[model samples]
Target: MMRANENARGRLSWKVAHRAIPFALLLLAAAALFHFSVEVGEGDTLAWDQAFLLSLRHADDVALPLGPAWITTAMVNFTSLGGVTVLLFITLTTIGLLLISRRPVEALFLCVALVGGWLSSNTLKLWAARPRPDVVTHLVAVGDASFPSGHAMVSAATYLALAIVACRFLRAPAQKAYVFVIAGSLIGTIGLSRIYLGVHYPTDVLFGWCAGSLWTFGSWLLFRRFLPSQA
Candidate 1:
């Protein structure tokens, strides 16, 4: 029994140790992406961006992305997850679920994280004032600056932040893994959908992911300290 307990404790310690490594890397990666976004916005990535965006298109028919019509249709649907309307729906639903579970303070923290990320994305868009992709015809219409894909940033912030909350509700390893996997898949696919539709450059989505992740995790660190009684 003592040996089994020690083995369980060792596994727990290992999980904690591995978790710390990624958190440290997240901070570093966020800084790196922000720096590169600044450089790209200033025209340093002109050749690379054009090359990358064009690669995703058919050579003979550059207007269309290099995929079947149905795939394009599916990508459009997936991309909507990052759109304002869809994101708002997700936000409201998550808040409702948290309140139902008697986690009001955590729900509030979730709201703050999401709102802050959205505002930051918009502010950065104005500051950068970068133009939308001209490499190919956009599968969907978009209006506004495109230095960072708002859809990418906002979805990543919301979904990933929700994963942190999910960890609290899910105790079993399989349940926790499933929750994180779904959340991560949504975050990744939403970002890719923007690039696939020719609405955002690859760099734009990349930076958005970085910024969103940094903000989400940072908020979690703050809110986790708010004990239930204090909350």
Candidate 2:
């Protein structure tokens, strides 16, 4: 039993290191990009993207309402019905799954990741303080500073975290890929929904996605390092 425990510890350490290195690099890259967006790209280019999305958001007579309608509906669902509520639900679900599977450490790690991501997103939002797109009137009321979109950030974190948790039990490469693809699709859909609904500019969504992804991986790395192996 001691030998088995030692072996498990060694494996966990290696796994933690392997997962952490790339995420650390990614965090560095995101920090650089965030700085660039704030220092250089915040004026004309950002304005143009905002205007473009606004045009699409306000296009009522553009002939193909179906695409926009579907996207808008999704945006509404993501913004209102699903949004933060779904994130909380997923967090709780992760906790429940971990408890059921007898992995309390992993469950606690997931909870921290979720809460940490949210806190980080809000902090960045306040720091950036970029305004929202001024396209057709905003479909939904939002007061937070823009730049890194909250919806996009939260959606990315939640879905990507879900994918990570799901991948923990999956052994097949194809299965892992499938999980990532589904998560990616959901994240992409949510980001696009924000743009289509005129609440966020394309850049805002892009930055938010980057930030959220960076944070998710970073959090995973942190958890892997500290999570107990008793379970």
Top-TM-score structure, candidate number: 1
lDDT of 2: 0.73
Q: Clashing pairs in model 1? A: none
RMSD of each: 5.8, 5.8
Backbone collisions counted per model:
0, 0
Across residues 1-231, which tens digit of lDDT does each residue of candidate 1 receive?
Answer: 999999999999998887688678777877787789779878988788888889999898879788679999999899988887888887889999899988987788789878998999999999899999887898898999997889999998988888877788666889889898999899899999998888888889988888888888878766776745322
The TM-score of predicted model 1 comes to 0.85
Question: Candidate 2 lDDT, tens digit per residue, 1-231?
Answer: 999999999999999898768877986887797676675244757667855764673356432323546766667775652277778887897799789988776787677666776787788777777777764566677787777787788777777877877777778989999999988988888887777666778888887788777778777776766654422
- Model 2 worst lDDT run, 10 consecutive residues: 57-66
- Alpha-carbon lDDT, every model: 0.86, 0.73
